[model samples]
Target chain A: MVFTETGTEIALHAGTSCSSGTCGAGIAQNPVQSLTPEDQRMLAAFRPETVEAAVKKTIETYKLFSYTDKILVACSGGKDSTVILHMLKKFGYAIEAITVNAHIGCYTDENLRNLREMCAKIDVKLHEISFRKEFGKSLCYIQSILKAKGYDYKNCHTCGVLRRYLLNKYSKPLHPDVIVTGHNLDDEAQAVMMNLFRGNLQVCARIGPKTGMVHDSKTDHNSATKKKFVQRVKPLYFVRESDVVKYSKLHNFPVYYGECPCSSDTYRREMKDMFKSFGEQRDEVKEHIIKSFISISEPLKAHFMQAEGGAIQECLICGEPSSKDICNTCALLAKLRDNKIIKS
Target chain B: MVFTETGTEIALHAGTSCSSGTCGAGIAQNPVQSLTPEDQRMLAAFRPETVEAAVKKTIETYKLFSYTDKILVACSGGKDSTVILHMLKKFGYAIEAITVNAHIGCYTDENLRNLREMCAKIDVKLHEISFRKEFGKSLCYIQSILKAKGYDYKNCHTCGVLRRYLLNKYSKPLHPDVIVTGHNLDDEAQAVMMNLFRGNLQVCARIGPKTGMVHDSKTDHNSATKKKFVQRVKPLYFVRESDVVKYSKLHNFPVYYGECPCSSDTYRREMKDMFKSFGEQRDEVKEHIIKSFISISEPLKAHFMQAEGGAIQECLICGEPSSKDICNTCALLAKLRDNKIIKS
Candidate 1:
């Protein structure tokens, strides 16, 4: 267990005082006393101070948010996002949280409860959106119908694209400066590997600390035009997933621990497993991969971006920003509708 | 077992009447009748027809060697090089073989014996180089002394650099147009991964099918100079190591199957294992990685080569063309001599 100098000072300053557990800025309540030696070491390495330091570094490096900016954290009641939300609040940042409830039965209810509990504890506002309310069908039903039609789409893929579409669509009204995500180093590294494996070098432009451009067909494609993209930020972009898990456990947040029921064998999962196994041998492999990716991403973008000279266009069906006439989300929905699975 | 349309014709034309087992042109006797079904399948995929087609394609793509040029096969009595030597011979190309006897006890004897037998059968000239004759001590002696000095250099690393240095140095008198190596897809892909892990993008320029430009310090660094590098080529660049093994065994080549006595765990070996594991899930992963490597090699070369404008220098000690004043081999030898591990 290692602690930064500041972390050690905080631990020493708060020796068994402040029972509310909020006084020790980044020091936990010595939860190490109850854990096995191995787990204790793991938890100690993930001390709030270390994780917080990484988050702070990422935020500063990417210029994620300012105190005056409206920061909207896309909370899924998962350990990553929950930790991010808690850390931002601890840092005295003005932040709001939003959760898209796909209404996956009891799981959805539990996730909502977790979000509400954390929001109440931090005295922050929580916004809940439902798939049925926004799209008139549960995600489970949509996936099932698509599967029955032999569409053979992955549930996580469908869920992720639709969820991002909803988050972006709904956040426009909120007028937030940035949409913060809980993407950690493991997630980002896995995503980079996935893109490499799929030979999608152009997609690398959408990675990095602060990425995703607003390619609005409604406006001129000229650089002078002010882009309206609500830049997404990942404060936990440098922290490892294991560290986040340890931090979550140390804080004892009521975040949902269950995996999504629709999640199954996937390429992402395979890459994640490969990374974890490699991590066991070389601790900095994930960091190295991400570093290598960043070094080449710009050059790769320069080489590939020129090939993609076509300006963004509006999806004919949904009138959303897209490279093609139909947005990816609308295309999937169209497939579902063609099979009489859903109505507009 | 699968058979290429042309492969079956080649196999049938030879029949079982070739007493010396050398009459069949790139066709092996049906040893499949005695093997297990799985082994049969493996060997079927390594059919000489497929391997030959790959060789032909690589030669055409890289313009490796012409009919009039002399070719040197750097055969370490290994399966890859022996197979290459035989394949080129079967194709009616004028070829010579060279083996480096590093004097690692019985292993060296066996390697030399295998080379002699193959050379005798094919009636190709074989050149044997000895470490003790050239360097005044066996490789084992220098490595042991270096290990005592706490240098802790890997045996394979030392052997590889020294062998390449000797090959390039000795082949000058013969004036071979191209030095052919037995590197297959597996070796190339593993090398690419190793470079990525080390964050050595500059080293990537020395990769690909036909790589390594001779930059003479005495001449202009510009491209017009017709640099006097004996270009290296890998005819089996697209074949997998496993397929090479199968091909070697199917033809009953008396190649030494033993690994180098001092082989150590390395990043390359780890990558090879990773690739093999992935191969279990997707057989085309090795091919994909090689393709990915080739796609980026040019861009990587363009980005890095300009930064390396310094022309190759004559090694002050050995008078060989090198990137530095003193070549890598001379540097190692200097260290050995400094430690009294070698004598002038």
Candidate 2:
């Protein structure tokens, strides 16, 4: 299963049987093709010499590297991450899988079970992290506690922040240069929209293939510092959500076929609905938005980095690049602890 | 306990009291002195010669009246609504109170309980509804279900939307010429900031003292139009949140003193924090925002009335203005019912 930008179609070309070793028809190949106008545009816009060329380009841009840099794909075992992992492996990059089983009391264990099976098939090392083990808390318990405390954000926010925290802290010993995430085009576009909506140009600058404040030289401190914030990359930054879904389907990829358990009460859904109302105008308007963002973001990005006194302080609890005396992850854990939630 | 906008120093002199006297120092028998500097200025500016004069000079110019006919107050049995009601009553206008209790969730019960006690004290009549009574679901239940459905907005958004829906629909049968709400300067200004942050000019137009939407000749349907989105008025439009808080405390008025159960999420809270860091600059900024809003809104309000097709067909289930066959509220409730929600 493969995806391309500027086009809506996913080409699922099955590998020939090891014994046959030829690309002619009936060597046991199932070639599924999706050809749509959306696909056509995506392909043309994000054109590459080959899938390998695209892969190498993404790796260099996202810095998914290793001196033994050991790239850990923070896979939900979802289509985007799976595709990312598969491509990285194809390019012969050192890689492993990290799955955070943030349960919503539904489909989580099942997804993890499926992910384990996929790891076995791929013969790659897969690491699993569970909220239950770390906090002795299930999704329900944490949700109830947060609700009780009048914590503001929706459930998905909690799941996301906690997942990023756990993935980073747990993977620290391995010292991976990159944590390859599965953020796709729609996700990137939404962040940009959200940031703009709130007049948060800093957030717009802070998110992307090379996200975060690099206080070591990278900019703004009053706003979201890229250095303090983790740098994130989207290998599928140009891939549409639809293509990923289709590719996963056609390839029989063991992906988590569900929405993020906590995303139901957010404005992004509102934006999606508004975006959908545009019909054929949707992609064009969205692309227009993205292109506008590219230009709008550059000066601010450089401006933020050059601002003085912007430094990443070491976290007191954990030696991560932090803006405060302690990092957000450690602060959150401390909050959890203060609430007696460490063993919830 | 009283409030006068004359900018006097609230002299508690042992002098003659006016008609219907409730005096603190003494029932003053002497004639009152002439107006102070601020009072003279206001008298010169407002020139409240008659009801029409008052309406035209102060109210109309500032948009205090949406309709010259009926009065409908969104009451919480709090000082804000109570004061609006009291003033409307003094002005010899028809008026009533609409209160939608969000089932209190134990905490809110205390608020409503206090409100009811105060209403009893003031002899202010209240028409009461609750999330449980009307929708057969607690906010908690609705929230959990919506969360499950992959919806994600700030919790306040859901609460605000539901309250608006209920208030508007219930006000439909009363057939008031205008719906009067206790939205003071703070609420209006905060909302304006929120809209601008989100790049939503349309929604911002829907707020303020005399919500200019009713006069938009283009889509200006009558208050009794099937959509039931009547005009909203705020007598306390110029009152600051701090002033309101101070007035309520000074008068020993019955008021809900806590924050909304779900407001500390999203960009508004962030804005609030940003303003807090700026101290009184918030008030200056708010005044500036509201001034700008009025300038833009006056013409937009006229255009809004003239605009057509803003309200689509009424929801079949609820008979409310809806874009689809059903409204988002009714649709959400239906989902809840399908999930066996008790109230829905």
Candidate 3:
């Protein structure tokens, strides 16, 4: 896959082929890419049995999902998501895949193609959504319009708000029991630290393997009021990012190794870098952080829930599940429309 | 003063003289040392009026102490402690000073001399204690003995345990209402992060401008049960370390700029460096962390106190205040005695 400098132009290219060149004619071939020395070292140290066991254990421990439940995997064509997808399929869980084509140049194009190929190979259904189709403009175009109109939001901020909105809106039709994402231990740890550093303790309460506010004893899980938002779970919550990469490489899974081209989230990046440097000195620092977070998550959730009155409201503008009268998506869209950056 | 490589030998010389060389003979002479370029820049940017107001505000807001209260300042001859001690004296708070001579080579020797000179200049009574006089050996000697006996404790650990024990024991006779330390914002932030990172939420609860577990609603502050440990407070709790350095340099306080020679607390050093780097990108990151910590500290302290039974115990051996049956100092001394490193 190739990306333009501005990430505004899409470049079409042939798909990656199996580099090992040893798959039989009848078998579904995977794109086996060359591994860097570091990748090779990690791959050598990767214990597939142990990693598989850990993933399964996390799923079981968290009661993430059952084999009978319909699981929708949020695939970004990244190593983490792709590994989880394949693992779930191999474990015989009824699953489907979904991807967002944010029109981020050739990046999303290649990711979407890889998603299609992997889903087809695994005999799972794939759902694709695009910003241009849904919002009448590519993500880059909307970002440019917002920038031209003096809105100073970062690319990741806009992308995250829109992508999350689309994921929830589009997945509602599928009626899956739970939506699964490929967030790993490192990602979860970063989220915990970022929320704390930003002084967003209430937000911190709404994160874990199963994301959301803690349910009070008074709230009924099966009540009609709780059905607006689909629950999200993470099976790979215990797996490290490096381990995911190593597992993906070991399995010759076609995945993108680079970060999002337009990602300018310096704070999160700094946190990631900090963890990397700290992890070098101490093994399982990320694990320690996540474990510590889990220990306090209950009280954190309870305190914040009580403080905020613990009600999930429907966005007045879009009727989506929100913590406020208007959801972040509807709010951002309103700003864009007010400035004539997007159609009303 | 100079510290040797092993930090086991003292090489003291004459005291620092005022570098500006403009002090009139009758005035108390301050050892005005040469400032680094960075220090000069900080000094130039230092707003003495604003800083003094902030310190005064923090004291009044926290009710740290009053003019009528007897304040015992923990003077280490470092920039932080020296500044706080001087500030308290200048503010007309009834204050005395105390120092712990750990005998960390020429480091403590120079600090001791500086402390004496500063106290004499300010007309505050000074009390001094030493490891050699109290424990029959210098700090280095004890650390060496522990190392030789395969105790594997870090120098900072041993020094901290012994120094804290000595401070509480020696300060008892002074009968001060509160013991004041020069803990700045950066130090408190680091302590918060370190405790959280180490999963010691209980320890984090025991820290703030006024350090201790939260007093339960039923417990009376005036009760004899709470009198075992002297209440410790920090007037410089909201001030940044850089500002403290600038304030110290601006006043030409005879303070040591370097860290302790025997310091090997890498975890804390890393936290400090992390804050420095983060501070470069975003101003007041430390303040944010500290403010957020304060918001949750009450719950943290209350929860931990309830879980731990909320009782301060008298050390079985030393009759000192401790959370455990035996104080850390008594336990360490026992270890040393058992190994024949110290007399029983």
Candidate 4:
């Protein structure tokens, strides 16, 4: 039996053990002695079966992937992504792992080490990409340069644009049928709210369990670029974040338990706290939010799809799929080069 | 100068004194000694002109009401409603006030007293309705009866349905062009979130500055009943709740500052708190929520309107406008009577 962060003592599976001590070392070191009433209530309600059933149901309902498909799992070295990667491999799928090292101080360094060890143990071929190698600068350095140039975007915003660009660009050579992300229900719900709060319904239209599934065949301008851009699916779309944490602990995954150092975005932190507050009052608040979003998502997609005729455009500089003449990554790169922050 | 709840010291409008003494007695009784950093920042940013400009813009932009229109303001004796009523009268609109006394212990009693005095002071005709005279029981008594019958519903839900029904039914005889409400930006933003969280997009479709403006003339079944149901408009749709409080204090309106005794619903309280948290981070967060909601509200309304053909129906029992054959109020009343909790 091992005590989790919520002070719940969980028994490991009968035959399962962390043969590699690195995987379960973090949990063993930090055995919480006390928990708040809310934590106790949440931990007491944790059911492994419920979480597994949700993942299974999401995959089958959404028809996310097939046995014949070669899946590429994006490992963020966090609990959510690590759990998804392990689950997909255990399910006997043809799978490989890919990660982007943005070099956010010691946070990324520890995560990368943990991810490398975890992948090698599972016998999965792990591919690594780095911000320094690809963009000639670490994410922090790029952010600092941009800040000096008076282009002050949040760290997550800059990193997100770059990471997505790299993931798509690099995955093409691997030729995977689909890219799998570990975005749980909590993440998706937060995204729905953030987009709504930012008046970005068109962006909201592009998210779901099967990302980028909604396409306007007639109006879309870049069918060629669309073919180049692989679809992404989320198997954990219906699972909760706490469930992911519980699953990660139960399986003894070697995952960094800390948040990204640069992810202190006030808006997202506020949203995360808001969800926690709402969840305490209604246990299924996250599920309700996702369900409501899904109900309206189709109409939202259809409306915007038809409204923005010739919606997708190939980036003039990088030849990548974009909503405008230039993709976000290329635009940022152009800004950096124009300010002589980075050599062209 | 008077110190407000947020610890903001404000000078009252020049020559505008609380000569009656009862109007500003609440503020005079106790002054806040200290303020949190958030409260200090919010108070520092208070501009009465900005609030007035928003209200004026909402009225003009939405074409909510005209000078010739007979406006019946729904006065709840709360700061929001009181401010809206005073603003409309000051704007030179022909206005009167109507209030419902739910008899929620001392809360509604005090509110009713304040409503009467404020209406008399403003030289507006005051119309009062009571649950005992209209429904044969007070709201609290009815709630207890329903709870005893094992039909437990939140007080706000029950009260909202009955109050809306009474407002429409009673306002018809007043021959007003429109029934004005005090739903401000914060309230509307909360409703948007609540409806989204509850997966009640159909209900969300019916809300806006000009409530119930989205109608399908071809598909609507109850044109006659609709005519009987006076439309409700919100002139303070763009104003913030805090601004409403400031406006009320500025004018020294006699208003009850406490919340309704029956309004301890956890879901709404959570939403309100979430907005407050978001507002602390971004001052225009509420505005963004409302703007995003408005952008998609038209499509939301249009989609649901067409989907729900014959959208409006006259309640079979009461002949009031409803979305179903039997209205919520009648359906609830039927349950109470059928359980023998309340005499028919």
Candidate 5:
């Protein structure tokens, strides 16, 4: 896990790499023989075996998944998602891949191409849900129309809400035991800091490696909609973004190494910058934040949950389990429809 | 507040200025006649009258002080402390001033002179505590010795610990209702951010406008040292550091404008810089952090306190109340003495 300014290149041990197909016949023959001595040294220090052990530790520590359970890897065709998918497949998890395409022009195309290519190589089925087919309009069209009508929000908010709604709605038939995301250490730390800064404790209570909607056959028996809420996990929770990038590149996954143009979360970007700067001085900055959050998470969750009052309601429009009468997705859609921006 | 890149000069309504003596006979006669229209507008937007109202509101909101209670202002001769002391005095509070002279070369002299002049002008009794006299060594001497021994700590840490120990020990005899320090919004926000970054929850739990030493008379029944612990308050907890500087200058309070030569809290400085940048975009940035912390402080305090467990012991060396057998002050002193650099 050697962090470099220009490029991130992690060196995994030959044994683990071989077992995981990270150093398959193709790469093993070529072996990024171009790595500098410095990079090689860094790679040796943070071997793949070490990173693999950490990933395993995180999974075990959080009880994120079971071997018998069906796992759905949420692939974005990005470095993080691709790396996670590759690792899980190599580790022999009963996993498949899903990509929710926002249909953001060339970016969407690139993502699809890369994702399809990678899935084909790994012999895994790739499932994709597009915004145009599901919502009758591309994310860009909806966002632009809203912007023209003076909507005070970035596209990311709308895209994220729709994507989450679509993921749950579309993945229902799969009956996955868990939904895995590519939320690495950097992303998780940024979220924790953001929630703390915004004084959003209720949201903070919901954050952890294995946190999301927990589907229980007995507890959720009264509400049919609650059954749609699947448990989500993150095997890459302890893995650094740098390590993910290095791993992805080293394995030659067809990853689109570009940021989303609609990444309007300026606050999150600032947090990432802070993490990067602090990480230069100490590598444990991200780990400290995550570990500390875990330590107090139970008490924090209990306190906030008690304050918020546990009352779940089904969204009137979508029949999704929500804290409010209308789910966030339904509320957002109502706003879009009111402005006559998003087509039905 | 109109955060400027070059300087921060706040405007005050003449009415409020007269009461606080900020517009003394000399300044009132001319009234910063050289201030440009832009500066005047900037000042008008962030007037002392408005700031005073906020201070009053915070006091009322937090129940920080009462008219019947005796208050001691911890004056550091800096802008923040000087402004606080002046405001409390003007508000007709039963207040006196205390200045701990760290005896850091010329810096100490400047602080003492300014404190003396301001106290004399305000007709308040000023108490002086010197590290050289009490600790048998100047803070500079102690810090230099510690540094020579490869002790990786900033001078501010040692200074802060010794100053706190002295303030509690000396102010104990006064038996004041509250000891107010000039920790403004910026300082408090920086501390909260630092604690979060450093993963220091126990320290974070001990933060807020009115937080410190909870004096339980029953718990201290058998321990004389425990009785010395006083409740510390910060009236300027909602006030920004820049505003304090402007208020100090406007009031013409004799204040040392120079930063301490040994002010080496790099992390704190970084946080300050971050605040300054964010403040330029949103003046309420500091307020936002403080408010957020306040919202979570109770639960956070409860969670951390339960984890820490309330266990207090008297220091073997100094007989002061401590979490361990040796108090922080004694521990620091022991480290300084270990190198055998301090004179007997």
Candidate 6:
């Protein structure tokens, strides 16, 4: 299996054997083959052509404000993020990439190196931040502590807290009018589940193309800030995950187009597999979910506005806006540092 | 620990001495007994009395609604279901217990026996439906086929689909105004996870206090000659799982309170554990989730109603409404009778 310049062919690996059991490796098996019917149907025949189309379509679809403002792209160095960075740059959005490295051993090592290499190739400015530099210890250290103390949490907890912190920290200095996240519709749907499961309605309300719960001063981390929330937008909110994969391959982006090793140990990975196993039925299901989110969001928001709960408090440790005195990230870091097991 | 005359408490387990890597099991190692107020406040106190209070409060808070019309109560003889049946009878709702016997070895046998005994003791009419009679094969037989073919589904899949069928069949004959389910908040929250993960928004939309999306004849089954949809209601929507356990104990109702042995092999159990570990934080999360569901549900419903492309089609053989030509229940039976495995 080889990929030609076009990177077209072999979309559905159904009847045939994808010995590796991964969509990326399987699809890329014979990238040189002529586009299959399924590939043609998805218009992924011209991988390079289709990716550009999706990015262009996404931009056109969202009809965002002028690209003249400072556009910051959150780069995880993964396929989706790389593709997003490339797409933004291609579309001539005044964009710069920011990567938050949690220093999670083998996981972040390859990703960070690949991201730095991509930035060098594309000649884009990249900002890097590490968890220890800001919070005093690595996430693995913190997770071990939490585990020992009987407060077992998933790795996503550490990743989420740090990533969010970095996003805010980076955005604050640059003061971008809007921050662009590589959150595709599927990612948004997943977040909807996380938010729904966590019962964090107010935070979820501000998760769409626009960001933040209310337009009140409580959400604004800085009093001198232009707006209460830093208008986070999703350019690829409507783009499919498969299309993103095609685009990454076509654009010759350096992305670790595979699931994180630890992710398989999670229930979410089970859901992801379920989604992957489901043939074509997923698009409609996702569309329904997005529309569902759109349905009660306004009423729920209004209810929140009418509620008597106080405004978001500033985290005493980090100054990030939080419902509690300490922010989630800081708390996570502290727990990690405190919980080191002296295994002799 | 000695149980009172009321059949709630019991004398603590005597002669327990074991050493697991995490914690040693001994009366001296009991944290509650060892710790003073300061140290104890830091850890969770699993008090039976507090659990009882929480359970009682949970039910009373939401049991305000008392339906005078005919109500069909779904019973599994499990702790949650039995407790619900007891509560509904106590509340004096015009209701009867309906159980679907999936015919899985000792599980369903014990379930039926326990359910029958409870109904006899409580003097309530118990309606039992068997899958072997209805579909011609036991659930255990169905499960073997699904597992052999690597269907990548849980036991809950067969049971869930079969339960819905049985509920409708029983509810239709009775012409019950509402089908009352023992779907407590925890179950609802987990369901919300399942629906979102699979992007089954229409089903989620169908999931509310009393209304579900069944208007579409192609996707949702219309079995009753009188009504197209069963007006389903949850009297225990706000009830907590811990409370349900406590309530079951307090009432001394004969129930198989332990979890379904099969649930341990499922992904949902993982989710349940994740939620359980959150402790009190779990409720805040559930409230936010309920709010989120209630938030965009209506507009999302309209979105789905407007663009709902597929419809539930009736099975050609059994004439049950199904998404495919054959209903899932029928498909299970067919699979059990034979060994061919091609997912529709």
Q: Whose lDDT is greatest here?
A: 3
- After aligning candidate 6 to the native by TM-score, how far in Å is the CA of B94 from where it should be? 6.2
User: What is the C-alpha RMSD, rounded to one decimal, of candidate 5?
Assistant: 10.6
Worst 10 residues of 6 chain A by lDDT: A7-16
Order by lDDT, highest first: 3, 4, 5, 1, 6, 2
Report the C-alpha displacement of residue B258, candidate 5, in angstroms: 5.0
lDDT of each: 0.69, 0.57, 0.73, 0.72, 0.70, 0.61
lDDT for each residue of candidate 4 in A258-332, tens digit (9 for 90 to 100) = 566577764677778877776564437667777866777767766675565534334765544345778677888
Model 1, span A36-77: residue lDDT tens: 678667766566797788888888887777889999999998
lDDT of candidate 2 at residue A52, scale 0 to 100:
39
How well is each residue in B143-195 modelled by candidate 5, as lDDT tens digits? Answer: 65566568766778888877887887789898899998989888888887777
Minimum summed lDDT over a 10-residue window in model 4 chain B is located at B11-20
Per-residue accuracy of model 3 over A237-282 as CA lDDT, tens digit each: 8888878878888987766666766775557888887776665743
Which parts of model 3 are misplaced by more than 4 Å?
A1-41, A212-228, A281-283, A309-330, A339-344, B1-45, B212-228, B281-283, B305-331, B339-344
DockQ of 3: 0.47
lDDT of 3 by residue, B188-221 (tens): 8888777677665656655678864224454343
Could you tell me the TM-score of candidate 4?
Answer: 0.79
Instruction: Write the number of the candidate with greater TM-score, choosing between 2 and 4.
Output: 4
Lowest summed lDDT over 10 consecutive residues: which window, candidate 3 chain B? Answer: B18-27
* Cα lDDT for residue A267, candidate 2: 66
**How far does residue B214 in candidate 4 sit from its true spot (Å)?**
7.4
- Evaluate model 1: give its lDDT: 0.69
Indicate the residue-level lDDT of A260 in model 1. Answer: 56
State residue A324's C-alpha deviation in candidate 5, in Å.
7.8
TM-score of each model, paired residue for residue: 0.78, 0.42, 0.83, 0.79, 0.81, 0.57
Model 6 preserves the real interface contacts to a fraction of 0.49
- Please report the TM-score between candidate 1 and the true structure: 0.78
The 10-residue segment of model 2 chain B with minimum total lDDT is B22-31
Q: For candidate 5 chain B, which ten residues in a row score worst on lDDT?
A: B9-18
